[model samples]
Target chain A: MLDTIRRLVDEQGRLAVAAEAIGDNADLYATGLTSFAAVQLMLALEETFDVEFPDRMLNRRSFSSIASIAGCLHELKEAA
Target chain B: MCQACDSFLDRLFAKGVLHETGVDGLYGRGQAFEAVIEGMDRLITRLAEGDHAEVIRFPPGMNRALFEKSGYMKNFPQLAGTVHSFAGSEKDHLALLDNIHNGGDWTGGQGATDIVLTPAACYPLYPIVARRGQLAPEGGLFDIQSYCFRHEPSKDPARMQMFRMREFVRIGLPEQAASFRESWLERARGFAETLELPHHIDVANDPFFGRAGRMMASSQREQALKFELLVPIESTENPTACQSFNYHQDHFGELWGIKTASGETAHTACVGFGMERLALALFKHHGIDTNGWPTSVRAALSL
Candidate 1:
């Protein structure tokens, strides 16, 4: 999971650095994760896990970070 | 099908309504309006549950500075609606009142700020995500429904000054972005088909930049990168776009400083459903008679 995030950060450049500075609890929306980017991340997660993300999980909290995403994924996996 | 839509449309044409403004432009009233609202409510509720799409509501307008920084002004100056500020002295204010009383153009004297109404629902989401820490070696998703505004005025029911957009956004790696878009293309098409709407998946080209926008419209027919789910709502000859599948290719992630868990530029994609347009399409296809519709369709729409 960390590897995936690391890769995302590296590719994302300064945003990755900003995210690190903000720490996990900081609001991603406030930091800079525009709505468009959130959608992009959602697509990536869906592909990575080979699972379809339920629509209900599409919210600010769900996309908060790797931890929140992983939690959502775990829930999805368990449901499956 | 909402009976209100039928009556509204019928009355609109019967009266030969040429052009109207505001929400009234679309004639949202009577039986047609009620049917449309009810139908949309039911459809959205079902989709929210079935797709697990979380819903977020944004203010009608967005921050002006953010919009300018996002390159919206450069991309769509014509479609842009700017907010204004008032910085006038008492004399200026009194003069403005006098001008209004005299039927003079008072709008010019307000000294407004250039804030814009949000053209798309997802524009605000990126800055929000950027505030959060980097993705934890994984990406994220968001489902947002927003009241979007665009200044382009069209008489067609498919186009409106204000509209509802349901968007599913994915932010992550390039491969992930491609895959997600691919999957959604299929899913969106399926959704439309379920409603008995005939749709074809085709590539979409960005609306041409600058003077080229006009040429792009013509060229789009040949180089179909922009994919749209077309259904007949206002006109049978020209199908209206009910849904669109877009692969933005990290344009936003780069702009907003969003990164994937791997610390790389994230690719982005979205599936947008124009909820009001869909409701309109459904009404056109199924007619406004709730009683005459099929049981299964009625059950699905909860009419």
Candidate 2:
């Protein structure tokens, strides 16, 4: 799930460096993942995983890093 | 961003149209700018007089408690500026003076006041109208203007820490509010055209906070709840929003318990013009020299 989330970030995020350059807990915003790109990633992730991100789960911390996104998605899946 | 724009700023300073106080995003307007602004205010009054709006004046500083209720801090925390005052004993005062003497953080002793500087002109009106109970059968219209503050300070002349927003707000049924927003948006477009500004209207949103703000912004766009009239003031590539039309869709009405004649939550909408931005747009398009402006434009502006 972490690898897949990292792959998605590489494909959709507006990152300045390759996904491989970032660690699992690296700060995405510090690495230049913009809000505009986050929305695009969110839409793609919702479609890819068939899991809708609820209002309570949609925040900067949720998309702060690949590890955090994986964590949130895992929680969402568990609840679902 | 161009030499011409910078040159005009200089000219504005020279001609007393604008006075720069050595602080970024803060300027003192001279008679010329104020005159033009007054004329524009008259123009707005004329255009909206037919609507018979009840004019309400809100002091620039709003009640801090009421401001807290508006949830402005939740959405635009970065831009919110709270009014703080020094409320300390003599010892604390001596310490504050000592800190200031040493050029340290003297503002730490300052406490929050009963007021916070107004962030938007329409914010104060919501609570005021809500307390009035149900609207009359014909609904309600309000005209208000205030000096609004945002914490973003920049050298860009268009982006100011303090500016004026002249707003016309309507409250009633959902369809009434929606149509009022639509109709006024066109009127605003026409108002820009009268000044011969190159303009465009597009869906826009308030700069929300953090990651959650991005989702809110996207949802706002998808739902088409807000729109902005963009004009080239600082840059043509990235036009500034000089005027905005917004439909709150019962957000404030529900929060404030404002009911309609039918005993339902009344929807609210507002169309506001950024007085300074629009003025800058006019100067950009017509050049800093108003004498060189087209006769029709001058006649329309009554300048």
Candidate 3:
């Protein structure tokens, strides 16, 4: 799941730093992920994991870092 | 104009500051009102003089194709206004007149024109800058003012359907963009002080449309991308936004292919003065009569 999140970040995060260089707890926004890019990442995550992010989950905290994104995905899968 | 309507809107009309146009949010500004707008514009110019910003004045309408590419409709479809014109043959024209004569919907034949009302003063500038290729090593700064249109109509005098926005836009690296917004945020407060207007700066979000937009707005606020300097105009409890400071990151630069001297996508920021709203705030806080205003406030506006 961590590897997949990293891969998706590389693919859709549009971060200034390489996903490999970023720690799971790194701040994605501080590393240059804009709200626009975050939306792309959200869409990509939803498709890859077959999980729809609830409107309540659509916030900076839910997508702030690779670890947070993995945690969110885990919750969504469990709920599914 | 109401005979005893104590609302500021009615007061303005009674004082010959505004002329009612029958529409809720549309009104004609009398000479006194226009003079205040002019003074506010000059004050903004004086404040930005040291920046040596390139000045560009665009008409209220912008290219429809460019407007589509702007993603404005996607964000705020409710506020978007498109220009439409009657494009019909002689027979269609006759049918249109007949429909109008019958008091029917004659506007059905109107087609969307090649123009859309410009949503913001800086909307047209980005594409123009992109066309010029890479920016200078110092990046770019511009002074722009335009009458912008938003579809929301309200009885609030400050919330006009058509309004003037004066902006100073900066396009460059992230730090450059952020610092530009930071500086202007402070400068704007000073401006309010100079104008003797009670104001406060706070985090703000655009009125993006729909359920998805709520999330977008929260994210925007979280990122601290937008801020507004609010002043009491229509309601003291909920002050009207008189000035806005926004940092667009690399959104426009990426969309319009604008680049810095180093060939990276340039970030952008803008500080916008809601000219009409500020004028109204000045009148509300000080008084309708400019001569009766505080000597310092009048001196600051050079009124």
- Per-candidate total of colliding backbone pairs: 90, 0, 0
Chain B TM-scores of the candidates = 0.82, 0.96, 0.97
Expressed as tens digits, the lDDT of each residue in B1-303 for candidate 3 is 444558888888888899999998788998888888888888888988899999999899999999999989878999889999999999999999999999999998999999999999999999999999999989999999999999889989999999999999999998989988999988898899998889999999999876557668889988788999999887889999999999998889999999999999999999999998999998899887777989998777767
TM-score for candidate 1, please give it.
0.68
lDDT of 3 by residue, A1-80 (tens): 99989999999987777999999899998998877778778888988999988888888789999999999999999988
| Pairs that clash in candidate 3 | none
Per-residue lDDT tens digits for candidate 1, residues B11-72, read 34443322244543344434654565567556646554655544677887888778878877
Show where candidate 3 strays beyond 4 Å: A1-33, A40-55, A73-80, B1-5
State the TM-score for model 3: 0.89
* Model 1 lDDT at residue B66: 84
Deviation in angstroms for B145 in model 2? Answer: 0.7
| Model 3 lDDT at residue B109 | 92
DockQ list for all candidates = 0.02, 0.12, 0.43
lDDT of 3: 0.90
List TM-score per model, in order: 0.68, 0.79, 0.89
True interface contacts retained by model 3 = 0.39
lDDT of 2 by residue, B1-303 (tens): 355555656677776778898987889997767767887898888888788899987777898999999989878999888889999999999999999999999998899989999999999998889888889877889999999999998877789899999999999999989889978987887898888899999999889986657686765676688899999777779999999999887778877889999899899999998999988888778877777889998887788
Tell the DockQ for candidate 3: 0.43
